[model samples]
Target: MNTVLVTGASAGFGEAICRKLIADGYKVIGAARREDKLKSLATELGDNFLPLQFDVTQKDAVDNILATLPIGFQQIDILINNAGLALGIEPAYEADYTDWETMVQTNIIGMMHLTRTILPGMVERNFGYIINLGSIAGTYPYRGGNVYGATKAFVKQFSANLRTDLFGKKIRVTNVEPGLCGGTEFSNVRFHGDNAKANDVYKNVQYITAEDIANTISWLVNTPPHMNVNSIEIMPIAQAPAGLNVSKEM
Candidate 1:
């Protein structure tokens, strides 16, 4: 079985992906900041799952942890960059600077760092797959989705550029962009722990579940080596881009 490395394995799409991959007989290195959650997952998954605890936002810690991968887990055939978050729902002018910074650091910088670290090995072996969790927010903008959307847009473009750079190589890069996904810590984190408000985001709506994304990743992994899925954007049927707003009496 090939070994796969997934970031943000503690919750949301990351957790679901881990479960699906392990079930399909793949050895997974699940990395997350929450050691306890990762430990629980490892316990449930048995020998196939190895838990590495570290915040992706911490560059030094990322390097140290990955550099010391044990002998059995050293070879990473696939990398799933699922460790991103949206901080706030306020417009740019009213948003916290720190929140914006956190999103950029984790969504863009951390993903790039981990990808860079893992690429050399893949290049040497001449085989690899890179899967990034982007968002439909990247393509469709909302009132308060400024920095978060921008970061995801970067993810989408970066994935495309990576494929171009790897032309002729067996390596594959895909950006999975999802919209209106629920059953994760996303809204809670964005709303800063306001559960009621967070809950409202999905109330009475049929939102996409983490399991849905997990299934998508599984399909990508099983796809033929010769085929490359450049980018996939998913959204709940109930959701669609809003029309342009105009001031009637300004």
Candidate 2:
């Protein structure tokens, strides 16, 4: 069985992906800042799951934790960069600048740091796979999606560039972008714990679930090594890009 390291494994798509991968006979290192959550998940998953607690937003923490992985889990065949977030949905003019900093640090800097750390080993062994979780917002600009969308755009281009840099190597890189996903704390976090507002984002709407993402990842990992999936964009059937707003003065 291959070993995979997944960041943000405590919740949302990360948690779902861990469960799916473990069920498919892969050893998983579930890394997240919440030790309690990761520990509880490990207990349920048994020996194949390793709870790795550390904040991905901190470069030193990621460097230390990944550099000294335990004996059995030292060799990571796949890296799943699932840790990211969106802050307030307020428009750029009224939005908090702090939120933008957090998004850039976690969504861009932290991800790049961790990827750089793991990539060398993959190159040395000539085998690896990297899957980044991007968002449809990257390509479609919407109100209040300013910084969040920009970071994801970086992720998309970063994944593409990694493939270019690794040309002729066995490593594979993919960017998975989803639209209007629910069943997670994403909206709640964006709303700063306002459950009512978060809940309202999905009410009466058929949105994508965490499990759906996990399933897609599983399919990617199981695909033939000779094939490479550059990027995949998925949206709930009920969700689509909005048309340009028109201001009319009659």
Candidate 3:
């Protein structure tokens, strides 16, 4: 079985993807900051799923996690960079700099650290797949998205450049951009533990589930070795383009 490494594997798309990949016969290294959640996933998924605990924002923690990988598990055929979140919904002018700093650190710097650390091995092997979790906000700016959108925009461009740089090397780089996804911890995290506020965000809109995104990822991973999916953007029908909106005065 091929080996895959997935960050943010405690819940949401990360957990779902790990489950799907394990079912598809991949040995999965599930990394997350939540030890209990990771342990539970490992238990449920059995031996194929290995739980690793670390904060993606911590460079030392990330490096230490990599160092502790089991010998045979060292060969990572696929890397899923999925550990990221938005901290606040405030506009750029009103948003706290702390939130912006957190978003940049986790979404951009953390991703770069892991990618740079693991990419050399892939390059040497002449085979690899990198799947980044981007957002529709990356392409279409929305009110209150502010720095979150900028960070995902960075992801979009970085993924593109990575694909270009790895040309002719049989390495694949893909960006999966999702819009209006619910049934996950995303909004909850965004609202900073305000469950009621998070719930309200999706109450009026049809949303995609974590399983939907996970299935898409599984399909991409199962494609023919010669085929590379560069980018994919998915949204529920209820989620029209960011441009299509009816505003109401409060």
Candidate 4:
């Protein structure tokens, strides 16, 4: 069975991807910071699902998790870097430096550390897939998304560079960018636990769901080996590019 490792497996696109991959017959290693959520997913998905608990921000913990994969789960055919978040929606001038730091650490540093750890093995194997979760904010910037957008832009560039570097190695790197996704903890976390505020962010707009992103990842992974889907940008119908006003009076 092909084994895939997914970070941020507790909820949102991560959880949905884990479920979809399991259903598609891949041995899945679901990694998340929340132990309870991981356990719940393992129970729900049965034997093929392995729940690993670790904070991606913790470099030592990430190293340990990658180093100690059980013999049966040793082969990692796919690595999905999905553990990332936007802490606060504040313009650069008014944004808290702490929030900026958190975004940088998780979205950029953590991702780099994990990719560095796993990529050598993939190179050695000469066949593996790496999917990085990015955002439309990376391509189109907006108010209150200063540092968050910058971080995702880093993801976009990094994924592209990886694909270029691995051109002849049969290692595929894909960047999946999604826009206006609801039904995830993203807005809630961005609002610092203000559920009402989070709800208001998407109140009028029809947003994409976690399952939608998960399905896209599944499709990318299932594509023929020779076909490498380099990048995909997904947006909800109700949303458009940055600075585009969709709610203007008719």
Q: For this target, which candidate reaches the highest TM-score against the unseen true structure?
A: 1
TM-score of each: 0.98, 0.98, 0.96, 0.96
Model 1 per-residue lDDT tens digits across residues 33-129: 9999999999999999999999888989889988899988998999999999999999889999999999999999999999999998999999999
lDDT of each: 0.95, 0.95, 0.93, 0.93
Tens digit of lDDT per residue, candidate 4, span 92-161? 8888999999999999999999899889989998999999999998999888999999999999999999
Off by over 4 Å in 1: none
Better of 1 and 3 by lDDT: 1
Show model 4 residue runs off by greater than 4 Å.
242-250
| The 10-residue segment with the lowest total lDDT in model 1 | 241-250
Looking at model 2, which ten-residue stretch has the lowest summed lDDT?
58-67
RMSD over all Cα atoms, model 4: 2.9
Candidate 2 lDDT, tens digit per residue, 75-133?
99999999999999999999999999999999999899889989999999999999999
Worst 10 residues of 4 by lDDT: 241-250
RMSD, candidate 1, Å? 0.8
* Error in Å for residue 207 of model 3: 0.9
TM-score of 2: 0.98
Candidate 2 wrongly placed segments (more than 4 Å):
none
Q: Report residue 70 deviation for candidate 4 (angstroms).
A: 1.1
Report per-prediction Cα RMSD to one decimal.
Answer: 0.8, 1.1, 2.1, 2.9
User: Residue 187 CA error for candidate 4 (Å)?
Assistant: 0.5
